[model samples]
Each structure stands twice: as C-alpha cells, then as structure tokens.
Target chain A: MTDNKYAFFIGCLIPYRELAYEISARRIAKKLGIKLITMPDANCCGLPIDPVNHEMSIALAARNLCIAEDMGLNIITLCNGCFATLTKTNKQLKKDRELRQRVNKYLADISLEFKGSIEVKHFIEILAEDVGIEKLSELVTKPFNDLKVAEHYGCHFLRPHKYLETENPENPTVLTKLIELTGATVVDYLDESECCGGTVLGIDPNIPLSLARDKLKNIKEAGAEAIITICPNCHMIYDLNQPRIEKTFSETYGLPVLHYPQLLGLAMGITPEELALDELRVKADKVLSRLVEEIKVKH
Target chain B: MSNEVKTYRKPLRIDPEFKNLVLKMPGGETLKICFQCGTCTSSCPIAQIIDTYRPNQLMRLAQFGLKDKVLSSKTIWLCAACATCVDRCPQGVEMASVLRVLKNLAVKEGCVPRVFKDFGSAILKTGFVYNIPKTRTKKREDAGLPPLSKTKIEDIKKLAEKTGFIDTIKGEESDDRQ
Candidate 1:
C-alpha cells in the first residue's frame, strides 16, 4: 500500500457490463510487471451522487480515496467514470480545506483520513508511467501486423475539462501507441472523442443509434479494421448498440469493437479466447484468429 | 429634443440553448471557462460519423437555454466518452462530463426516447439487458446454439430485478432504494 503497487478500483460499469475490459486489463498489467493491488471493501466512486446522496456521494468517493491513502497507495481505475469520480473528488478535498475537514470528520469513525496524499491515475496513465512504453513496445510478441485500429476516447476520459489526465487529453497517442506496438496501424476517425451518446441512449435508443451510425460511417470511410475503446460506457454503446445502429441507418457496419485492454492483451501474445473474444458484438473473427495465429508463429 | 432609446437585445433571460446545469464539483468547474473553441471538434472521432454533432457546439448550446435541445439531440446520446475532445479542447471544456450531467439530467427528467424505452423496461423489469433479441433466437438455434426460451429470459430479468439492478437506474445500487 506504500505506493509500490496500485490499489485497483474496478469501477461498477466494467464489472456489470464491460467484464472483458477489466479482465484483459488485469492480464496485461500482470504481464507488464505491475501489480494491481485491490481493496476488498472498496465502495462506489460516488459518481452516482449529486443526483442521489449529494453529501454522501462526496463522502463515498472520498472514502475510496482514503482507503487507498490509508494503505499508502495510489488508486488506479480503468473506467472513465471512476477516474472522474475519484480524481475530481480528491481534487475537491484538496482545494477546499473546509470540505476536507468535514469529509474527514464523517470518516473519523470508519478510521479513514484524507490529507490529500493519495494519488489517482487512470489505467492508461499507469501503463504510460509505471510500465514504460519502451518496455511495452519490447514485449510485442505479436505485432498487430498492419491491423487498422481506430482509437475511441470515451466521454469520461475526454470531457469535463478538468481531468487533465496523465495522457495527452487532446491528441492522445498512448492507446494508438499500444496498438502500434503490436505492429498494427491506428486510423484517425473524425469523431474519436464524440459522445457515443452516453447513457442518453438508455432513454432514447434512437439518439445513440444515429450517433453510432455516424461513428460507423466515419470508421467505415476511414477503412479501419476495428474501433478500439477505453471507457466501459462507450464500449457498451459501441458493442451492444452497433448492430441496431447498422439496421436502422441502412448501412452495413461490420467493424468489430474492442476494449483497449483486449488490444494490449493481443499484442502481449495472449490467445483470442483469453481476451474474451466472445464479448465483442461485431465479432473480430479475422482480427482475433489472425492475432492468435500470429502470436503462435512469432513465439 | 429627447430621443427614445429602443433595445431589441432583451436582458438575457435564460437562453435554454445556452442553459446548461454547471456541475460545480467542489473543484470550481473549469469547464465554464470554455469560449467556443473548436479544438475539441477538430479532434472528435464520433463527429465525423454523425454530422452536426460537435462537443464544442454542444457545450455552447448548453450555455444557451436549449436544455431540451441539448438533452434530446442525437449528439448527447452518441458520445462514446472517449477523452479525445477533452484532450483536444484548447479551452478545457470537458464537454464530455458536461454531457454526462445532461445525460443524468435526462434520466431525472424521464425524457427518454421511445427506443430507449427498452432500457427503462430492462431497468424496471430486469437488472441486466437482454442481449439476444427474440427474432434472433431462432437464428441462434440454426447456428447450433440452444434456443433461448421466453421463460429463461423472464427468469433472468426477474433475478436481475431481484438483485436490485433495476433500482440502479432508478439511480441506485444500495438496498435502501432511497
């Protein structure tokens, strides 16, 4: 907990819907020599607060940060929602001394304190920082081998202006870099950061479908092999809703959607099954089979 | 001679187009500092897929009184939540999170689209989403996969709801259901 390894905060989204995102992430991080230390009693990021328990949500997110702080470790998260919640809440406690006192007072009984010492980093940030890109590049047992990948930055990662992440918030190149390490190519999509329509799609399926259609059209026009993503929410929309979007828009979008971790797992030479190939809605049969066989050949 | 002064530019009552609920996350929201910069638009990937969807423009619209317009726009529903626009925006308008606030707002307002009704039913009736469509089950049986029964689907939905998953969208994860 003394900052040597990270306290893994597997946000709600991945566990509930985006399972592969976390599974592949765990597998890849293990391979990279970074240990994802987990907290047994980790609570919500309190992102669901503001709308529910405003004060309690603030305290809940702070509690998670404090749990990491107590262990003397930095909290690392994969989902953008978790990242925003943990980071912003931590930022809040630090900026407002009064709020910090109240939050600490609330947690006094739970034996947690927030002296603004705990650090929160996104999974991508840890990959870039702890596991040097150079080393990640070296471990490319299986290069993507010219696979065309379109990088998708989900809303939580890119928006709200304040989450100036470890990775370049704008013109992010790390996900692309990870893909490139596998000897694959990254394609530029005009709407890479555009909202996959957020949970708005949950209420009005049409809105997200059109947005996905717009995303697919650009990806298709770009002649990409797959759409790669990092956020679970974004991944959910793209993976679950893409087929419906295709039917509605009258466009044939067969592009397979991938989580960032899956792409890294492939480059690390893991088998397709290990990366949870079944999770992808638009199956990457060629992409998966080719990567698997290529890894076997290379090794 | 006294001249009467006339002003067509009325005092800015709430411009719904420009009306966005600024979520001041105890961190003094820097998102409000954005000044119509298009750096985010130039870099957004989803922007190319769906024309008329721009993070920067959406941010600007939220500033106007276009609450309904912003919430119901095809753009908000489609944001993939990639940090690309936030990364590219010169003004630091994390329009991404701003849109999330709008999304949460949509849920609160219950202003969901009809197709989106599927999500509501999924939430109210089942905690988990039904992936295999009824029409597609027959096709799956043709592929040698076992047929998905209506009873099995209902059971799954019942279990998810029982587990309080449906409540998660009523905006919850706790047993309290508050």
Candidate 2:
C-alpha cells in the first residue's frame, strides 16, 4: 500500500479554477496515504477540442499519456472529462496500432512516445476500489450520520462502456456505496443517469440551466441536505449554477453541492478550511455546522 | 366535410457527397447504420428540453443528404456528447460522434456558432478552453495555495501544430491539407 503511486492528472479545471476540489482531493489523498505526484507540463485533457477535431483530441491526450508512461506510473484524474479522454486514449492506443503510430510520430518529434504501458483511473475509482468501504468508514472520525446527501454520478463516470467499465451504466451503485460509507443516507432522485446538461451551455444556456433546476428540485423534494458529485463539470452545473437556476425558475432551493473528496475530507475530521468548503458557491454552512455539532456531542 | 388536396414535396436538395464526407471521419463510419429507431432521440436529455434537437431527425436528414440543413442547424451543436444516445442506440450508432463530425464540417464551411469559435480560439491560444484570470490567482494565493503552474506553451503548441489545430480554428479542412 505504501508503494501506491499515481501521476496526478490535475486537469485544467481543478488546478486553475476549482481550488476547493483540488485542496480537498489533496488532503484526502494524503490522509489515505496515497502519493499523488503532479505530472509535469500536463496539458488540457483535450475534451473541449474533441468535438472540433477528433485526431487532435487523441493526439493531445496521447501527449499526456506519454508524460505518465515516461514516469512509469498510472494516471489518476479528478475531472470526468479528463478521465474519459485519458482512459479512451489509453484503450485506443492499446488496440489500434495505426492510430498509435500516427500519434507517436507527432510525439517522436517532441521526444515523447505513447508506449501504452500505464493505466488511467478517476479519483473516485481509486477511493472506492483501493480504499474499501469498511476501511474508509474506519477512518471517518466524524460521520454525517444524520445527513441526507444525493449522489450525482455524472455521465462520464460510467457510460461509454467501450472505454470505461467501472460500474453499471444504468443503475450504478458504486457512488451510492461510497456515499453510504460516510454514514450519510444516499437519496435517490429521478433521472439519476441524466446528463448535467452543462456541455451545451454554450449552445443554449436555458436548457442546461433548466435541466440543473429540475435536478435540484428533485433532490430537494427527496429531502437531500446536500448534493455530492465527483466531476468538476457536474459540480459547476449543479453547485455553481444553482442560484442562476433558482433565479430563472423563481424558486428558492439552497441545496449545497459537495465534491465526493470534500465530503470524504469532512468525514476524516479535516477542517472545513483545509477542505476549502467555504469556497463553494452554494454554501454548505448549515450542513457543516450540523455535522460539527454531532461530533461535539459524541466528544 | 370538404376534402382539400394536400401536396407533399420531397426534399429540394440532397448532398449524398456530404454524407460520404462525414462517413470518412473516425466515428462517422456508422452514420448509414442508423435505422431511425428514435431511441437516441428519446434518450437525449437535450432533445427532451429543446423541440428542435431531434437526433433521429438529424440522422434522417443526414441519410437524406440534407447537408445544408443538418450542417447549419443548431441541433448539431446542441448535442452535449454525453454518450447516452451512443449507449442506448440499438444499432450502435455513435450519435454524438456523428454530431462532432458534422460540427467539424460546419466549422469548415463557416457555420460555427460564436460560442464554439470563442471556445476553440481560447484552446488554440492557451492550450486550455478557459484561462485563469488575475483575480482568481490572487484568491488562491490569499488562501495559501501555491500559484498554478504555467503550462509548457511550446510543447502544447507543437502538438497543436501537428494536429492542425490552427487550421481547424481557421475553418480550413486540415485532413486533406496534411
């Protein structure tokens, strides 16, 4: 277990924008005794450009993969888009020699090569698989025993079975299992497999915002104190867009969103400041205070 | 009741050549396999929210070679690429991938929406779709986090050049040019 190391692929979103996810992820990984060395010069996961140029997307992802292979460690990504891109790239390179040859030629010029040796895992996968649920619960000094949290397993975490095969695409219980380990009740909502609709925000924002609102309405109605997600894009859509959704629909649903790592960090007795919980757009103050009071009573 | 004769007209123009063009893309090879099952359309969240975004109709338009209509329609850009349709499609049609191919063609023909162009140009320049602003850096620093590492711009630039990223942004057909 001490030798468990991964080249942390801190994709463009987490490093530059989402500091709370970054901080909490780091804190949790440290607490769990996992070594996450930053991959040097890790570029974008090449998702934004995927729709524009498929070859370029593969090539860019190949470049990142080559960086990790050079270091002889598997890659772990925090963002779902990055997880999909890197995992897809690895799978594609392993199966298609011609595509690998073409991408390798581009990398050859830059003194890099895609040897297809290393693997890619999302942080959620690492937590769930490497850290078993029972062991994870043992590390929880403060649990959300009374909290009702809804798990938003974003689309990429399970779909496109050709590339990723972590859980059942239709009825994924892996996220639920992880949430339950925190001693919180996992609430089910309608359209659990529904896309967060953030991907088309550029095309027509109304639809994505509306989709977010509907999801929030369902989660609130299900009596969830907070929403938890693993992907940054999903977090942005649910947590960052809640106020906009409320304003658009003229409703007051103050549902706080938590990254799975943030929740895990809280359960590990990490201070809210260390987890950067205060940075969330939809405040988690009430939920955090409730958990804190529960811990105080136990003490 | 009086009976009035209704005239149904066929599609005025069909560009089978455009369909052939899309078929050459990596994931576009399965375009003709779609049987108009409507599974994709029904499964698409965006299609449910927006009346105009019907994946089944888009497939039919492509099959009918309605190149101009399909390429220029807001429907192609509206796909979230969530792969729900791809997973649900009975024929294994990669609907989202086909949409991407259409989007590429749209960009080549100068039919790209402003949002896509802005997003594309940002990646072309910064190797990232979004760049961190100064205020964001200050906030992170004040919170005691180290400054975000600067990307190796040249390495990314080289990869971008090889991929014809610049040409894609310029709306040129990079595949044939290379």
| Best-matching candidate per TM-score | 2
Best by DockQ: 2
**Per-residue accuracy of model 1 over A205-276 as CA lDDT, tens digit each:** 566677777788888899887888888877887887777777777778788888877887787777676777
Candidate 2: list runs displaced more than 4 Å: A292-299, B1-11, B144-146, B172-178
Model 2, span A67-90: residue lDDT tens: 888888999888998998889889
Worst 10 residues of 2 chain A by lDDT: A290-299
- For each candidate in turn, the TM-score is 0.68, 0.92
**Model 2 chain B: lowest-lDDT 10 consecutive positions:** B1-10
Task: Determine the iRMS, in angstroms, of model 2.
Answer: 3.4
Fraction of native Cα-Cα interface contacts (under 8 Å, chains A and B) also present in model 2: 0.63
Tens-place lDDT digits, model 2, residues B23-80: 8877788899998879998998887887766888877778778787777665677888
